[model samples]
Target: MTNPAAAALIARSNRLGADPKNTNYAGGNTSAKGVETDPVTGEPVELLWVKGSGGDLGTLTEPGLAVLRLDRMRSLVDVYPGIDREDEMVAAFDYCLHGKGGAAPSIDTAMHGLVDAAHVDHLHPDSGIAIATAADGEALTKEIFGDRVVWVPWRRPGFQLGLDIAEIKHRNPQAIGCILGGHGITAWGDTSEEAEAHSLMIIDTAADYIAENSRAEPFGPALEGYAALPPAERRARAAALAPTIRGIASADRPMVGHYTDSDEVLDFLAHAEHPRLAALGTSCPDHFLRTKVKPLVLDLPPTAPVEESLARLHDLAVAYREDYQAYYDRHATPDSPAIRGKDPLIVLVPGVGMFSFGKDKQTARVAGEFYVNAINVMRGAEGLSSYQPIDETEKFRIEYWALEEAKLQRMPKPKPLATRVALVTGAASGIGRATAQKLAAEGACVVIADLSLEKAQEAAREIGGADVAVGVQVDVSDEAAVQAAVDAAVLAFGGVDLVVNNAGLSLSRSLMETTEQDWDLQHDVMAKGSFLVAKATAKVMIEQQLGGDIVYISSKNAIFAGPNNVAYGAAKADQAHQVRLLAAELGEHGIKVNGVNPDGVVQGSGIFASGWGANRAAVYGVEEEDLGKFYAQRTILRREVLPDHIANAVFVLCGPELTHTTGLHIPVDAGVAAAFLR
Candidate 1:
């Protein structure tokens, strides 16, 4: 933070990176060259500060900047090997560190350091890439910017590409930047302000040129029946198909999913030329690295029957894997990194939009965004000239490059529930919220479902925002509402791998005091609601074909036969039996159904705050505030039960430790003998 040059470099990077029009997430690098007093020699030494590997520009900090000695970086030119050996130079950047090196140098480090400018930026703007991927890109660049920018033919990013750009800069002294053919753009200036402006100018000029010269209907006009379906129908279909697609995508390894039906994506998919252009795949390295070489597109029209489309999806998934493996076979060399994955990361269903999968939700979402960028690039390229991306062989090389392999190896190991998604009912507060929080901490993307949408969303944000959790409203007693909540989970994070049937209500009443309405309400919300939730989410788990867990939040009252608790006890007892029944039936599908029985969770209990606490206190002959302690006194362990205790029980039942646990109730009631299984 003390270094002025590095601070200014971060500022400039943030400005350029804040807008998607400038660069996609974590897709570009920026640099500033300045003089720093050496600690050992006490002499001014030239230092190059650049954005490091695996860091996003917008969120970059001082530690994310890689500082290298300029003289040592330029020295790599003396022993420069041929293009085939360019990758070796990346390791060499480590030796050129000015200090502790800040962060690991990226492959684009040489490009930033070698250029003779005080500041430099390399970006993957959609407009710039449009011209870069155009068939007539070189001439188009000349026509668009005249002498202000030059064009460099496609070269894999490495030491040699850096030298290529440096030479181009020397020859064209008047040029501020150049379009990297079949790639992106790089701009430079004597100051940070000028450098950022030059980058924007190049991007803006390209966008304007495309706009002026592009012909109408660049995607070759929308096919009549392929247009997007109505909003409600589109979402319903998306919800129906997401699980199957997700299940297929997770075959290689479990993957979290993200769904999008943006106008840009729908428009592109609806066009006549989409089939041909999509087959060619994305041009930029950044695009395909996340999105994969191509998407798995449903060949059927948007209006196809749901069952018919489901059948075709299975066929398409099989074909996609085969095609991907063949692509590897065709271009893979002996030294190529072993095939990473054979599944398509992006799945395109014309009316339903796109579904992208990754190890986590953020990655899946970003992959989808990158594909949108590719769509924009394709639109622009086809508008002016025919879209022409690098050949498949080059894409294969970059996809399996040793440097990329090294980056992947550097990533931290995933958590136990890393790729799993969980849906917790009544998650807006108390035990349900605590359970949702714990599951999310263990790395599961969670759906916080409560009767109140506002409270559910609030809890979700508190848990970790949209990346890790989403909120939806549902009255669990309503079958239709329960299905919609499950659908929301599928649409938000692929399929549901875990379901917590925790939504419930309590009415402490004796046989004479309890009315038909009270009995129906308590049973309706607890026993029947649990059934509805389990049934709805089970469908998704079945579709996933991956083993899952469903835990019910029953009560100690289910067995203790406490006075004036007849209605509540019966509902809880019903839930306990339902767990055993469903576990027996669902075992075939790898879905484990379990229950947690808790002794009067009064503190932080929404049920207690909603009048059940006073009613239970009256039955126990204790003050309302003393109810938790009174319940604890009756237990052998004499420990007050909190929401977190029940939450921990839920986690133990569903977490890695309980892989074989099901068809049982774990008492989290501090050893209540009456509640023990008998």
Candidate 2:
């Protein structure tokens, strides 16, 4: 049988943790107290089982819980000592760990220990933060909870906060919880159920109050279409701007970029007051640690040219960093450490959408989640009266708290490619998409450049997340668009480490039957487009002084052409020649240029979706449906070459395997005697 206290606390933590509305990623914590035997003495002691650092509440486990001696932890608090309470508090939590738990306790462990109830739940719910940060928050909270909830002014979480909570707990034995200004709500009960229920109840009550009082604002850009542009145009716009924003927010670190136009996000941004509303500092103190006090606002006009947008992004990025440095200077103290991040985690782009940047996709999405929660809140807050968050000084205290710094310090080390960025053209689907997925899985940031932004975004979404693998639209043959796409990749991911020149268009007509338009399309994408992307991105690689890989997805038809596939074959041949030429020129600079010739990818490759494969199948006297097997059987190994197989070959070049190999084309077409090089 489980200890009743632990049972309730665990249940509550799991219940609240599962819902984003209740807690952002790892944002809230809970604790339960029960007497436990000290293994050495077999004597009962008041032990607190609390959420540990790096543990998510929704997935709490017994091991994930940090066990500490409550009495020992409370005693660590020195009464009116001249010592720094913040630093001293950390030492106490460390010392009080039961058997050291071999786990770092949650940052709020001290405060949880101070709560008098058998169970305590602290959550940064959307509703709670809304009420906590709204104008006249104290009065509104008092009105909602009456005397059941005590109101505590915002205090940085540490020993001092623990002391305040303990004093409040003792003073108001009948109180169900406390509302911390510019922070979050805390609820307590004799059982885990009561504490968790009331914790949610606090959120519900505030939500009801805000909903009843606030006015509903119509959501709109009132545009004719969802994006007010063609699918291609919309993609080009997002593709062009995403990297610029990523580069600006990077601050010399590899920042994962997420561009989203979710209905909730865009609806909020569509508001006339969206800028002012989002300008409000983070609703809760802990989120300040992830997103900073506020988001960087980018009012990039939708109609502006790509170059102008890039310039604006640069200007704003400079200003934001300068402001951040100034903010740090204002709060610099002998006790304060240097700021870890000099850039805002969130960026708001009205008339478009918003972006979240972090060291990785998970972190960036976490920031995205916080902003979405803020969107949910600002509505209710605005509906009632107004949103009022903490000022700059308070933001400084929480953002720079030693405990917060320690939390980041405890994060796991990044993967080998975590800092490297790659660009894959024609990434909307097929080999390009597969390559992007593989590179991202290996920890490299991927810029998915395709002709269709929507398809690129969809592919990016499928591979990890939108932030980790970004999508851009580029007509590789268009010099301006190709340059913009490269700029986007550089700005978004810092510098380029790899380029998969794979954008291709298959043509089944012979040169005698193919129109000039169709022939040019093939040459433009397969040959000229590859050249433009390679050339533009090469400039970035050369400037960064980082050796990079350029891998081309050339077709076996480059060397073995079918009767009706003259245009595609010739174009592919051109790309192969360019690969060798580029390898010779770039090898001097440590840039490896290689090509892979793949055959028999008719089904999942998506290259045949345009009926090109079916047309070729007719020439072979086979049904379109049998095109895959037909080609597979023709190969020497009698095996189908999968998109994943091609992707693996691309990875070989992207990784260290090709350190000494260049100007080579690895064949993935099983064994084609005509295509095999001596």
Candidate 3:
């Protein structure tokens, strides 16, 4: 039986074909299909569809419509091709469809079949065409829509690509559409109109953004790596390297073709101007889970000091491991398993494109995708600044989270810390407010202590939950005030099981011109204040026979001294030391102490607004408007630290999950500490 929508779709395709700009031969095509189910039988009865093939959509018609039995077509593809036959396979596929009283379907029939939606439409809109043409196009898409759209890199279009799309749809049932690298877009919806509207929106938005932004220049020539090597030598090196990669990889390694001739490849090898190349085309979180933050960028020249190069790569790997270990040490539960090993998922030899090694296919695939996305994102963000990921420590905790494991247990509504009480200092804003909110959310009664009484009350009001949180005004540096606040918290919440010392002031001054008064002031606020809070909180926790979590808010400056900020640096340095001392002394009393040293955390607190933000802008002699971009450019992840990021760390440290963790300083600086050494 004929479907009205299918007929209209055929007419629309023919009309579109007449428009010159819309009728580009090789650029894109549109397809529409109808879905119907028998009423009592409740099964798909027919698929009447028009699929545009080689002909331009602008000049297409009913003749371009391919009619076929959907069920029969599915059966043909079910037991599809194996490795050996190529031409024979193609001939067989064509013969079966044509001989079965069906016209040739769209080349994208396999992909369309994967969608569960009643109507599916695919097109390479002009706007998408412009975006896909750029080197960092995929990243630009993410920067704009993030997870709202799924992205698939360019793959040789056919069965394999179809399978990939099918898997993606299965994984993400709610995806609006997907953008194909160097291709166009595929959109699906319950109705034809909805799908078309989604496609139009994606393309129009992408095109508008591209038009507003400057066009990207073509990538320069690739640098030299294997291209400089003799042909035989290059093949031998590849063969030799293949086994090592395979041995460590979770699955069979695919042979990587060497770029011994392309000038673009050679240029990329010879220089590090394009760090994105090392990361590009990798899948998301997959690459991150397997390979970690950054892959090693190997320099192949003999004169480049092979030992130094290897050492640098090894150092990068070691740093990743150390950061991971530190994160685990800070947030691991007493019952959590130990971390296994540290091996990067992917490596980039100067001359080679990329080598992804993983414990399994899933890991390798994830690693590859992450690197690819990172590359594209970095490239796109380069125009604005750079794409900075979260810190190594933060990533590690997320990757090896104990709570994530706990989720696997599927225990029902078990409160791990039902009777616990927590005290959060500087709870009026920033990390403190976030921690207080988190603790209350997790069923712990909380005390919000802040210098500003109004802000404290506001914060307490915001963290509204069954677990009550009360505000207390206290100057942490004033010993009497801190003691009183702690005492009040104990009276209100019954006792304290957690203490988050997140209150501190930042005072920036050059060492040469720094006043002793400023140095003392910084020390009093950060170090002395933390000590008083710990001392007061410890009494309540110890008396209650409850081991508690005490977290100090340090800074990236603590590790790498800040420039023109001697007072702030000195105070942070001391704060870190105090954490260690507190951990040691409090251990006997079953108390845990830790520090969260965040780098470049912006927003939330007025620390940056009153301290670094105001001062750094003046120091750089730039307008306040430009400081954010300036700082963003200077960092690796290029992400400004949000208060939630820091607060999340504190939550992990204080939660029942970290019962065994203590005496550690975790850096939430997005690898800024390593940047200093680099």
Candidate 4:
């Protein structure tokens, strides 16, 4: 943080990375060469500070940069083992670290260090890549940039590529940058400001040239029947198909999903050239790494019948897997990394939109964005002339490269609930909120469903941002609302793997005081609501072909005959029975149904604060403020039951530890002898 040069480099990297037009997420590297005091020698030494491997420039920090001695980096050229052994040079970078290198050096370190300029930027801008991937990219570069910018033929990024660029820069003294054939662009300057300006200039010039020369219909005129469907219809169709697609995509491993219905995706899918262009796949290394070689595009249009489409989807999935395996077999060397996965990360349905899957929500979302960038590149290339990219063999070389495999191995292991998505009803406060927090902490992406949207969103924000948790308002008793909540979960993170039926209200009243409305309200929210929520989520779970969990937050009153709790007790009893019934019926689908019985969670109970505490206190001849203590004293354990205790029980019942346990009711009520299950 103390180094001004590093601060300026971070600023410049962030500015260039902030826009999708400049580069895809985590797709570029920037560097600044500056003089730093050598701690041991007390003399100034020249150092290169470059964005490290796997770091996103927009969020780059000092710690995310790799610092190395310039002299050591340049010296590698003399001993360079040639292009065949270029990959080994990456390991050699360690010896050049100025100190404990802040982060692992990237393959592009040589490109940044070898260049004579004080600042350098190598980015994958959509416009730059369009020209780079065009059939006559070298010729187009000359026409668009003239003498100021040159062209470098395609070469896999490595120490050899560094030498190539440096040699080009040295020979062309008048050039400021070059359009890299079938890759992207690299620009350099004496200062960070000059480097950024030059980068922006090349990107803008390429974009303007493409715009002016583009055909009237870049994608060969949108197909008549392929136009996007209505927004509501599109979402409805996407929701229906998402689970099946996700299940197929997750065949190798469980994956979270993200859906995007942006105009870009829709427009691309509707075009005539989309099928052919999509078949060719993306050109950029960053784009295909996330999107896979090619997406699985549905042959049917969006308006097709759901059942018919579902039937076809299964067949297409089988074909896609087989094709992916064939691609791997054709290009994989004996030493190539084991085929990563046969499933397509992206699924494209004409008229509907795109559904992308990944190990987590953010990754899934980014994959979709990368695909969109690919779409733009394709549009520009087709408009200018013919869309051409590096051959399939080269793509396979990079995709299964040893260095890429090493990077994957370096990633941290996933958490227990890493890819699991949970929907917790009544999550705005009390037991529901506690349960949501605990689930999120364990790495589950949660949907905080409650009657109050504002409160639910507040709770979600507190748990984590949209990636970890999202908020949705629902009246669980309303079947439509319950279905909508499930749909939201599927759209947000593919499908639900866990359901917590914690939404409830209590009215402490004697038989004489209880009315029909009181009974109906209690049963509707707790009993009927639980059934509705279970029914909706179960459909999705079934479609996903992935086992799921449903835990009902029942009450001790379900078993214990407490006075002045007629309607509330009946509702609890109904919910308790549902746990056993659902467990029996849903067992075939691997869905475990369970329940939790808490005696009296008064401390953070919304029910307690909403008159139930005072009513129960009046019935027991105790002050409302002393009600919690009074209940605790009556319990065998003589301890208060709080919301978190209920939450802990929920976690255990739904978590992996109890995978073989189902139709079980956990008691977290400080030993209530009277309520003990027989």
Candidate 5:
């Protein structure tokens, strides 16, 4: 017989509306029993109660109990497959008996059998289902329950599933229960009442939550056009239309099915601008694992040729695959694994709902849940803004992150290098000043390295010192001044990790109009000065064995040959190549090297104003505003690059998180290279 407290808790669970339809859509049985045996004596000890599979806990009775020898039941799983299912599966349970007759054990009986606790209870709660169906549900569970609960993504319920739960139980001996995705939960305790009480509390809390936040309002009104079609006609139309969407034909028809009579669907069908339907279908990271990045949006006119539609779908899928391959090729390392499989995780059928595919029922459910959550979030966040999927490089890093996988096994902690210490040349104002400010905001200490003593002091005062930042006047072009700055850095903060070589002069003149004096001045300030600082910093770093980062601020003109500014371009180009060589030689020593080529970094910098004032007057015979517009329009993204953007690139290079990256030049010019190529 069930304990009175367990019975009450089950009643509360049902009152809270925590029960969902059983897996077979029938009234299912539930029971609670305990198994106790004296290991040393090899004799029956005490009978513990557990919930039976077919009984409902809300009105449980003692007669619903299933009795078995705890030791015998536990051993059966290890040897069950060896015996024929007809004789061995249910026949073995007859050896042990308690008050009432024994019924077939829960499908998860093996899992319950392995637990040493006295009392156990299991329930199919609606709250658990709702949380499991949401995006980032595992994280949400952790937030609510702390470490008391363990979460396992959806898996089939059977013998193999029981083994999986056993493994988790072994790993987390203290876990009270696990939230199984697309399924319910299993809560266990020393007393049946305690187990059932906790289960009731959790489900009640979740059900209350869902009730409070549920959005039952329709997204749009029903449409007469779709409602006019017969059910058979609608099903046929959906199936015939499915193949037109790449990767959609293979997916199971949506279990919840598509919206046949919604105003949103009708409006979508009327317009050619429905690519957003696919973008809206992706709202969470889980979907990416299932669906790849983007899905095809199918919107075919009634008069369109069937052959053309089929060919278009095939072509779209092939193109997407090719793009994926190109991204992998560009970002994948030699140690990277081969592509796992080729199939889109989700597909958008224009005027219809989204379709999600997976290899199995559990995977399919996960994909579908992710798709729905993503669509909801996208809809909620400012009415369906476009989603920018992570680039191929980032995806490859995530997919092949062995170190990250290893780290997941342990608890995480904050590191000392979580914040950076940066030294910026000519940082009193202009690009240097802007770069220093940007770095500090991103959890970095800024040392304003400049030649002007007064300006450095003033800039430092303005930027503040709470962030562990200061100003040091040092002529980077001067060897003694550079050495003094390095010594000051070591004395002030034990070490420095990032150096930005931004101090330089630009002299614009055609090659034929250039003088030897102009060429020497440009090289000394840009090339030689960068080398001097790097060499001094390298000596200090090698001794301390604390590798660092160095970023040279080059120019877009370095990549594209121009008529004038030959000296500046040549010097900048040399600085870039020098960074690559430094990266190769110093990589083993744990130092990274990179460069940034920014196009139009105006605002705070005197360099941009000075260079632009001269260039606009001489080249375009126009004012500065017109020149800014001209440069901004020349870029493919049609945006002017800012000093903050360049600083961001430099910060990325200096970050310890990017340890594997080196010998790279990131152009922070808003797709200027693509424009130049065109």
Candidate 6:
């Protein structure tokens, strides 16, 4: 418990694990061994402290480090005298624990314990792996690192690999580190600082060598973000590809979160022979454990027709899954359970960058981040020599390792709206923005659509976190823009699970004073816009074959024709009617449609911010600031109907609360008797 050597090792592991480039997620483990007094007998015994299996080193504490009897662990390996350990070796690990303080030792404990040094730091830095995964890796290590490094051939990590490393070290005796071909390197010293610093130094030297020797070639970029592509081509490509990829990735589970790559991805896939090279596998054994042996390489020609693109994407996905299954079948042992996810972690599209997905945005983003680093690794490794990662069989060992599978099992369950996507029109401000925020908070990925693309983007940023929200410029009256917005939502978030038709324009002039032009403007935006959004998004919902909800933001004036509120009221009335019509048509498709009619919400609303409040307040003989109070007092409940109130009502309809209700209108006008729903 008081070993300074073990404490230092734990601190070093945290530092190394904190950087993904140094070691992939939960991939590498470190160790320190020293003599300690037994708690019960006060007898001096040599103990080995190693990182526990399935724990992230970056956040690992002293307790997460396992202490084992050095003699017990070493004795088990000595008796085996074999290249690999069978399943029974797991039992020996428990018997060797110094105390209950240490949990199950990492699968690599035998390998760590075999090293004779007082401290050992094992890492899978991409820079070092860039060299280790090369065809000429063994020679290159000696050439770059000189006699300081010993080269070991790829061995399946277990008791045998531990014995092999020990034998290699005994023979060399002087090398500070050993390079495990197609895997990672291990560095050791008498102290944690020496081992940790030298480990990083070796990695840095390899990176410098690659940078100075390898000349990077320039290649054309791919279609990554929608804003990066031509407007006319953006929606079509995104709509056809995103959902198809989603369908492929979500064969067993929904892909609620997706991540599109950037220009670095384009540069990786731009090589003439990238398709073949990418299939070789990840740059290191650690990355292979996470991203599978290789990414799914696809062909997405920019000029292909929409129908052809869909077919092509679908066919490629099918082939990728089949290929993955074949890989699993070829390497799988009868004792090993099937590898958890058959889906490829990274999908590489030539001239189209890469795509990654997960159950949620953060996970998907993590996948993207790791894959991006993978590209860098491959580039550096290939530049030195041919990129040659560990063989597929070795990959299967790590990928299906019982320890690795346990991590996935430990993941938390999904949230209520997990894997669902929602679109909120006019989301740049007020009620729609509130609704979008609410949906995202409940676990649904949100798409924010507004007339101003800039404002839409601003709103998305303020309510930001990656993959949770995207901004789309949509003038809901324009059929093309409306369709694009819906498709954009589907493209960015996999599919549309809910809709909020909240975009509308006001024309509160009396019918006699209202111009034909004024009437058409209000009708086109409020009535027609709502119809367009619902129609386009409904098609996506139907295609998904998942029941969804659509709610319209109607006005209380729809229920009563108030003074100087003809055009606005008429438009709202038609908009309200569309809710019922949509419910009637889409109910068979399992889409429930509803409406929320609120009186006045002046705070932060564009209706008030854009000067409409001045005229309304003048008519009511009160200042503009008092308009909100006026509406509040007019309601029988005598309460203010805030934007959040409307947002709350819409959320209820979107969730299970109103799953059985449709063709319904909910009034959030506090207590407007005439506006009360029947």
- Candidate-wise lDDT, in order: 0.92, 0.78, 0.60, 0.92, 0.57, 0.78
Q: Give the runs in model 5 whose Cα sits over 4 Å from its true position.
A: 1-419, 674-678
Q: Which ten residues in a row have the lowest lDDT in candidate 5?
A: 251-260
Off by over 4 Å in 1: none
Q: Rank the candidates by TM-score, best first.
A: 1, 4, 6, 2, 3, 5
C-alpha TM-score for every candidate: 0.99, 0.74, 0.39, 0.98, 0.39, 0.79
Residue-wise C-alpha lDDT for candidate 1, range 1-678, written one tens digit per residue: 347777788999998889999999999899999998999999999999999999999898989999999999999899878787888899999989988748899999989999999999999999999999999999999999998999999999988889999999999999999999999999999989999999999999999999999999999988888999999999999999999999989998999999999999899989999999899999899999999989999988889998999999899888888999899999888888899888889999997799999999999999999999999999999999999999998998899999999999989999878999999999998999999999999899999999999999999999997989999999998999999999899999999999998888788778999999999999999999999999888989998898899999998888888888788999999999999999999999999999999988888788999999999898878999999899889889988999999999888888888888789899999998877898
- For candidate 5, lDDT tens digit of each residue in 1-678? 444533543454343223332111112223344334456687755543444444444444544445555666666666767312422344455554444474445444555555555555455554555455455567756865777777877654444555566677678887877776544566666555576666666666655655555544213343333232343443334444432341222322211111232333334333433454454333222345445655555445433454665566666667666666676678777776666544455555443444454432234444544554344333222222222333444445544444323433443442323334567888887678888877766655667888887887778778775235678889877898897776555433334567888987776678897899989988888899999988877665554345678888887766877667888889988898888889898887777888888875656666656674466346656576566566677788888777778877887777646778888887877778642422
lDDT for model 4, please: 0.92
> For all candidates, what are the clash counts?
0, 4, 40, 0, 22, 0
Clashing pairs in 6: none
Q: Which lDDT tens digits does candidate 2 get at residues 1-678?
A: 455677667777888989887888787789999987788999988889888877888988777888889888777665435335466566657778887444677668878887778888888888888787778778887888998888888776666777788899899987888888878888888877788888888888887887777766623234332233443565456655665566566655656655556677766765567667666666676576677777887665556667776677778778888888888999978888776767767887655666787777677767777788877767766666687778888788777877767776777887756756899998888888888888888789899999899998888888865457778888898999998788677545545778999988887887688999988999998899999988887776664445678999998988985689888999999999999999999987778999999986875555688878878888899998888888888889999887888989988877755589899999999888888775
Residues 100-200, model 4: lDDT tens digits: 74989999999999999999999999999999999999999999999889999989889988999999999998888999888899999999999999999
Instruction: Say which prediction, candidate 4 or candidate 6, comes out ahead on lDDT.
Output: 4
State which candidate, 2 or 3, has the greater TM-score.
2
**Which run of 10 residues does model 6 get worst, by summed lDDT?**
218-227
In model 5, what is the error at residue 154, expressed in angstroms? Answer: 58
Q: Model 6 Cα displacement at 5 (Å)? A: 7.5
What shift in Å separates residue 504 of candidate 3 from its native position after superposition? 0.9
